[model samples]
Target chain A: MKLTGAEILIRELIALGANKVFGYPGGSVLDIYDMLYKNATKITHYITAHEQGAVHAADGYARYSGKPGVVIATSGPGSTNLVTGIATAFLDSVPLITITGNVPTALIGKDSFQEVNIVGITMPIIKHSYSLRSACDIQRVVREAFYIATSDRPGPVLIDIPKDVQQELADYNQNFEYSMPAKTIKIDLHNAISLLLKSKRPYIYAGGGVLISGATATLLKFAEKISAPVSSSLMGVTAIPYDHDLALGMAGMHGRYAATKALYDCDLLIAIGVRFSDRATGNKDKFLRQCKVLQIDIDRAEINKNILVDEFLIGDVKEILDSILELLPENKNKSWLNHITKLKNSHENLLWTSNNSLTPKSIIESVRSVLGETPVSTDVGQHQMWTAQYYGFTKPRSFLTSGGLGTMGFGFGAAIGACVASNNQRVVLITSDGSFHMNLNELATAVTYNMPLTIILLDNNALGMVRQWQTMFYEKRYSQTALDRKTNYVLLAESFGAVGFKVMNVHELTVALTKTNKITDKPVLIHCLINQDENVFPMIPPNGTINDIIIR
Target chain B: MNSKKHPIFLLVHNHYGVLTRVAGLFANRGYNIENLSVGCTEKPSISRMTIVVDCSESLLDQLLQQLRKLIDVIAAERADPFNSVSRELMLVKITHSPESGGQLLEAINIFRGRVVDMAPESLIVEITGEEDKLNAFIRYVEKFGIIELSRTGLTILDRGQVSLITKSNNN
Candidate 1:
């Protein structure tokens, strides 16, 4: 059938099983918007106040569902605004597709109105990009973009369609040929098995790659077969259930005391689907030095990018775990497990603060009592680390946050995405006062959609994370960490047509949170007041390892 | 001693902005590209690039892995310097006195180079060989005023029946 490029683009997305997308409209995207309006019943398009929020919504959707999320925008500033969200997805390896409308083919390099080279602007961050010149290429390009965005080691891909191409007529068809790059994954478990046999104490360090490959079940089985305790990076916090006996929650800077100590004392480190980021490995030289490292990742580039490994396997993590599960005999390392259990018991205070005063732990504990396993997201700050430390997650993909890029304003937009993807369940956005002001304009998006979301504002009246850094590392300079604002959050939420709750203590917070459960028609902003002196502890100073850990 | 410069070959889809992706990968990763030469191969869809990057073995391993990750690239492998044949084309414009012209011509001939263009004051000598050979030819005639020099960096291929394009496994 013959159809315009804009129509074909919408049809192609629908055929690819995309029922929803997020974006903002402008001059160049008029034709695409017109087509979207006609096919509004087929595909739902949610327009956020800013393009950045839309892209982030797409990213959150992708992260929560493990599918490619589509975000569309127009030219120039509209496209440039999506850069941060695009880079965030790139850093976290989220599968996202960004479509932009450019000036017509005739005005490409002529500096026409609202013309910008979005493909060029997004080259470094995106996995790949395409600038479409012809209307006939719409179906193939859309399919190709989707394929590239969701392939191995997935990330974002950009497609820039000129205005003329969107209006041009093309013969569209459903059939298309698509093939991804041939992945050559060579796996050898011989040396890995030998190293495992010779080791007495082994630790399993899993990361987002395990969750990305949907190998969480295999990861648990593998850990059981080896009788090893598990530690997760910030990206992999929910990979293993927080309640599991062998699971010692997050391990790194703000990691639980037992997990970090195990990373140091283990004889063998079986790193699965992880990148040893600086935040994860404070000083690589001192952290992984004692262990014979066995690094397993799908991307070959990540194998020796940070640290040298004694043995490595480059393949799908699920397959690799299965192969390892088959090759090795089950060894119940009772002594090592007992040692770890003792360590976990002794250092349990590090994970919780004394609840004599109102604190993030008490507030989080109250929220968890009300909401369970609803897929929480967070903005970067002290509250994010606190939630990471306190939230008891039981499944993979249930906890979403900006682990790699650590963007401050990432929570609200991501919550909207998750809320949209998981329709009936209410999603939660945990943000600090400082991070909340970055993109609270997204409140309009949540209100307009009437999304069932709970925005838990941990109002400390200061940037607690950086303030703690200034106090510890920079001789208490304090600097610009103090932020005092006079705007009332309850009134602000009321003006946005959402429910607002002001809570000061644990009882008040629990009561306010219970009220939010009944008011599920719109978003609820729970402004929980707390002291600014609270800081994330058990921090390993930058470039400082086990010896330099500060527990206070 | 370990050599720093390594020539890596890539088979990429022939299209626009492909070079930018490859070049951006190097620049973003802090790897230096010493030289590069690329052109179409026997297949119209596939082009070949022989990029020389100066880095350690570990960085080279990372670079090769990153290059292979590019969607347009069909294959990425480092050229075997010991078994592969490489050549470069250099256009050197040199100016000399009439009496010194005879010496320059003798020097160019010894290096198996020929004059592609000539004027009253200068002549452009075209030379095609390995980088060392080109350097030697320039050294032999450096006393004469060298006006300009341009080179199409090394293009390399293995000394075997199978080529990268023919040997690439798409499956």
Candidate 2:
């Protein structure tokens, strides 16, 4: 059959099982939008207020659904706007297909209106990019884009279709075929298993790869079978239930004291799907000073990129874990477990504050208790660390935050996406005032969709994380950390036609949360004014070793 | 760390802005490209680039991996200095006074170079050889009052039938 390039692209997306596309339209993409309008019934096109929001929504959807998210935008500023969101997806390994409309083939370099070399601009960040010059290449490009975006270490792939190409006629062969390369899994577990057996204090450090490969169940079984305690990176917090006896919660800068201490004391470290990021290991030399490291990751390049490992396995985390589970005997390390328990108990009493001020910790605890298993997304900074430390994530994909890039303003669009992807499941956005102000424009998106999202705004009236750093290290020279704007968040929410509540104390917060929980039709924002002087604790200062951790 | 000069070769799709992408990758990472040469391959659709960088072995490995990860790049590998066949082209213009013309000609013949073009006061000599050999030729020509010089950086190929095309296909 013969069809326009735009029609073929839409048909290909539908064939690939993509039911939703997030985009904002422009002149260069008019033909594609026309085709999308015709096929609106088959696929829902979400028109976000900005291109960044559109891409972020797609990113959120991909993270939530474990499938490739689709996004579309026009050329020039429209395509450039997706850069941050694309980088966010790329750094975190979220699969996304970003389609941008370019100027016609002839006018690509002529400086025609809305013409930009988007493929060149995003080459470094994206997994792959294709600039289509002919209509006939659309089918193959679309297939390749989808395949590359979701295969192996997933990341964003850009496809630039010129305006003329979209309007051009192409022979659409429904039977066109492409085969994905077979994934090869090769691993030798002898050394790793032997190390695990030989050590007195063996610890398991899991990362996002566990969740990405769906190895959480296998990880839990392996941890239980080996009787080893588990600690997670920020990205891996959801890999094991927080309340599990063997789970030591998050590790690294801003990590739980017990978790960091366990890492410091362990004799053998079995790291799975972790890159040993600097933030996760304050000082690489001191992270596992006396421990033999056995690292497992799907990406071979990541094995020794940051911290050297004594033994390594390069393959899918779930498969590797399954193999490890099948190997060898059942053993117990009672003394190590006892030591961990004592350490956990000793540090347990250090997390509370004496004042009655509404804190992020208390707010996170309340939210977790009230909404068990509800997916929570957060922007970067104090609130993110607080949520990672306090929220109990019992399942994978339950907590989504920008880990690698630490992108602020990421949660708003992602929360909406999670809500949509999870079939209107109540999603929460735990964001600080500094981070929330960056993407508050997205509040209109929530109102437009009427998504069941709750915005837990932690308004400290300053860039809390940086301010804390300055206060600690720079003799309290605040600099530009303070955001003294008079923008009323409650009134802002009301302006967007959403319910708003202001809570000053724990009692008021509880009342606001209770009241907001009852209302389901519209999104609600609960503004909790936290103390400006408050800072996230158990912080390891920059370039400091894990041993140099400050408990206060 | 001992920084040794390594010649890295890449076969990429012949597309616009691919050079920018390759150069940008190095620029962004703060890796210095000491010398670079690019041209079309036997297949017009493919282009080959040779980049010489002075860095440690591990850093070189990282650069190779990053280069291979690029979308347009089909294959990337480091050319062994001892085992690989490498050559660079240099064009030098020397002062052609009657007093020095004879010495310049003798030197060019010894270096197996040719006088490609001649003007009244100068002669342009072209020499093709390894970097060290070209440097020697330039040094000898400098005594004759060289007027100008241009050199294409190293272009290398592995010894025997092992080609980048076959290597990329095998992967």
Candidate 3:
């Protein structure tokens, strides 16, 4: 069948199993919008208020459902706005596809209106990109983009289609016979097994790879088989069940005190699917210095890129773990396990703040108790750290937050994406006043979609994360960190045609959460005002190890 | 600042922006690319790039792995200095005259070079050999007053029947 490039894009998207697209349309993409109108039943085109929201929604969908999210935008500013969102997905290794329409091929270098070279602009961030000059190449580019975006060590890919290509006629083959490359990387686990068997204090430190590879179950099973206490990075917080006896929550700067301490104490650190980012490993020279590191990851570049490892098994982590489980015999280290259990127990009192005031701890506890296992997303700040420290998630892909990029305005848009991915199932967005202000414009999106999102805005009236750092590191001058954005969020939510409730205490929070759960037709905002003085504690300062932890 | 230079070869799809991806990867990581040469291979769909980057051995290995992950890149590998045959083409233009005659000619002959242009005032000699031999030829004729020089960076091929094409489909 002969079809235009615009129609071909829609057809190819449906063929690739990406039925949901989040984007904002404009001049260059009018032909695509026309085709979308023609094929609205097959693919749901979500119109976000901004391109950033669209890309983030796509990222959220990908993170939630483990499928590449597709987003579209027009040329120039429409595509430029996707930079932050694209970088966020790139840092987190989320599979995302961004399609932007460019000026016609004739006006490419003439500096025509909306003629930006997004392919060049996003070159450093995206996993791969394509600028389509011919309508015939669209099918191949789409397949390759999808394939590269979802393949080993997933990340975002971009395709810039010139307007003329979209309008050009091309022979569209429904079955173009695009075959994926065979996964032929052989795994060698002999050295890893030998190291694990002889080790006394073996600790399993896993990260986002476990979740991305769908190896969460396999990781837990392998951890249980070796009886190794499992501590995860912030990205891998939900990889291991929180209720599991050996799970030591999260391990990083703002990680659980015991988890961070256990890393240095262990003799053998079995890191799986972890890149050991600087945020996670404070001092690279001193991190895991006492222990022999064994890393298992799919990307070979990540092996010694961060910190050198004694032994590394490069391939799919789940495959490597399964092979290890087959031949490795179970071993128990009573002394090491006892020492860790004691550390965890002794550090519990110093973990975080507690009690009934409208605090992060109390608010999170009320929200979690009321809404268990519901997927939660968050923006970056003290509230983000608070949620990571307190909301012990049990389900994989349940705790979606930007770990690598630490994107401030990432929550509300992501929550909206999660809701769409979960088929209108209610999800929570925990954000702070400072972070929420960057993305409050997305509230109109949630309201327009009638998305079932229960937003728990922890308005601290300041950039509490930065304020805490300034208070401790600086002379407590409070510089620009003390922000008092007095926008009435309750009224703001109401203006967006959504329900909002203000809560100052734990009792009010519980009641508001219950009320939001009951109101399923529209999005609900629970504006929980937290104290500005509160900070995410148990923090290991930058370039500081477990020894330099701030407990007070 | 004595930085080690390593030659890396990448087999990539003959598509636009493929070169940019490789260069962008190096630039984005703050790694310096000393020289880069790219051309289409025997396979029209595939192009090859020879890149010399100032980096440590470990950094080259890490970069090779990253380059291989690119969607357009088919395979990437470090050209083993010991096992590979390497060549660099140097085109040097030197101030030449009948006054400063056969010493430059003698040197060019010693390096088995041919003169592409030999004016009364200058000489443009084209020589293709290992970098050391090319540098030696330049040093031998420095008294001739070299005017300009352009050199293609190192390109290598392993001394075996196996090639990156085999590494691509099999590895």
Candidate 4:
């Protein structure tokens, strides 16, 4: 079929399993808007108030759907506006395909109106981006962008198509095809297996790479078969069931004491499918001082790249693990397991109840007791920390919190996305009042999707984490942390055609959760007014080692 | 494969600061490169780069791919590997190194390898390979001194791809 570049691009998107696209029309994208208008029934186009919001909405849809999120923006500011959201997806490793309209090819770099170097602006943040000068290349670029966005270690891919290109006619084939090259770098399987067998106190610290590589089963089997203890990074939670016997919970600051201690004492630290982010390592110096680290990751730059792995294996986690399984010797490390269990039990006392009046941990545990292994997402802040500490994410994609970007307002949309992806699985979002304000407009999106999402507003009336820092380090010189003005969340939910409730205690929480769980037809927002001035304790001071942790 | 093959060596600063500039150029231009390795040179602050690509002599033009931007990558050149005396070290420990002492010794002799370590029951043999030497050694050592082995993946230098200073001064 003969079609315009805009039509061809949209058709390519449909071929890539994309149904919904979040964007807004502008002068530069008028041709695209016209094409979209003509074929609006073929694809769902969402007009968001802001380009940033539109990209985020698309990101939320992608993260939730396990499908690449698609967003569109016009030239200049429309494209620039998506900077924050695109960077957020880049940092959080979300699969997103952002298409933006550009100035006409002739006007490009001629100081044209609504012309900014969007391709240059987005180059650093995205895995890959292109400025389409040729209209004939639109189909190939769109197809490649989707492929790049969904490939190994998924991330956002941008396509900046010139206005003229969109209007130009082309022979449109409704099929997109591209093959990613198989990894050529090989890790010696026998050697890696022997290393595992030789080390007595081998421990596995898995991360988000496992989820992207689909290596969760291999990770679980490797840890279980070796009877090795597993300490997961925040993104790694979904890769392994939290309730598993070998699971030692999340590692690093705000992580379970046992998990951190295990990391500290481990003889062999096998990091699988994870980039060693600073948060995962309390301090880079002490992360694996006593261990021979075996880093199995797909990115070669990451191997022996950061935390200094003694043995670096560059390959997909799934492939490496399978090869290692074939070569491993049948030797059990019973004594090493017993010693680790002993060390793990020593910190059992730290798991005691927090004495703080409005403990975030208490609230999370209360919600967990009612929700029971349900997928939860949280926006960034002290509330995020509290939820990570208390939320039992027993399954993969069950705990969708931003780790790398720590993006505020990510929880609401992600929860909506999770709900959509999992066939209306109960997705509860634990968000602070601060992050809630950032993207609370997404409540409208939730309403539109009719997602079975429950937004739990951890209303402490202040930016809790920042306030805690102010109290501890800044001598309590409070800034704009306090949002004491009430915004009546019940009315907010009602305005969106969803049920809203306020919970005061454990009984109220359970009751409210039960009621929300039943109302799957529409989304529900729960405003749980938590105690103000709450702090996420057991913090490691900036640049401080794990041993320097301050436990309150 | 009748295509011309070239082995390029870019002696750069040991600083990892140059990798992005070098890799970005190739990625942006959509060049399909093969077998690239970067590591520290004999000098403490210098890095040796080994890149292998196949194309016509015009392939040298690909150096415009960010080579000028990198201040740390002192120079880059094509080298002939056949004439260069290249070597790679691999430590292989076999299971029967302890029980089959005669077999282990014979295998080590065949590969001209010396036992680097012995833990009563295991032997670690250090062997250096020149081009196809390591592959041949592995075939022989697979029977005795090879329980585990770690190879510092192929690093090479050219016979005549010396710095311009020496050649220019000589000329």
B101-163: candidate 4 lDDT, tens digit per residue: 887688688888888887877778888876478888888767664568887645665456655
> Model 1, stretches more than 4 Å misplaced?
A177-186, A352-356, B1-3, B165-171
lDDT of 2 by residue, A452-514 (tens): 799999988999999999999999999999998898888999999999999988888888888
iRMSD for every model: 0.7, 1.9, 0.9, 10.1
Question: Which pairs clash in model 4?
Answer: A64-A417, A238-A396, B93-B147, B94-B145, B94-B146, B94-B147
Predicted structure 1: lDDT: 0.89
Give a tens-digit lDDT track for model 1, residues A98-153.
Answer: 99999999999999999999998899898999999999999988999898888789
lDDT of 1 by residue, B1-171 (tens): 254999989999999899999999898998888999999998898899999999988888878888888888889888877999999999999996789978898898889999999999999999999999999888878889899999999999998885775645521
| Tens digit per residue, CA lDDT, model 3, A1-552 | 999999999999998888888999999999999988998999898888889988999999999999999999999999999999999999999999999999999999999998889999998888888888999999998998888898889999999999999999999997797878687776777888889988888899989999998999898888877778899988999889877878888888888888888888888999988899998999888888888989999888898989999999988888888888899887866888788778878845256674638888888878888876599999998888888888878899998899999999998789988988999899999988888888788888888888888888887788888899898889798999878567898899999999999998888888888887788878898998777778788888999998898776
The TM-score between candidate 1 and the true structure equals 0.97
On a 0 to 1 DockQ scale, where is model 1?
A: 0.85
- Single out the weakest 10-residue window by summed lDDT for candidate 1 chain A: A347-356
- In model 2, what are the clashing residue pairs, if there are any? none
User: In terms of docking quality, how is candidate 4 classified?
Assistant: incorrect
Report model 4's TM-score to 2 decimal places.
0.76
Candidate 2 steric clashes: 0
lDDT per prediction? 0.89, 0.87, 0.87, 0.75
TM-score of chain B of 4: 0.70
lDDT score of residue A446 within candidate 4: 70
Q: Which number leads on DockQ?
A: 1
The runs of at least 3 residues in candidate 4 whose Cα sits more than 4 Å from the true structure, single-residue gaps closed, are A37-41, A110-113, A174-177, A180-183, A347-349, A355-359, A423-425, B1-171
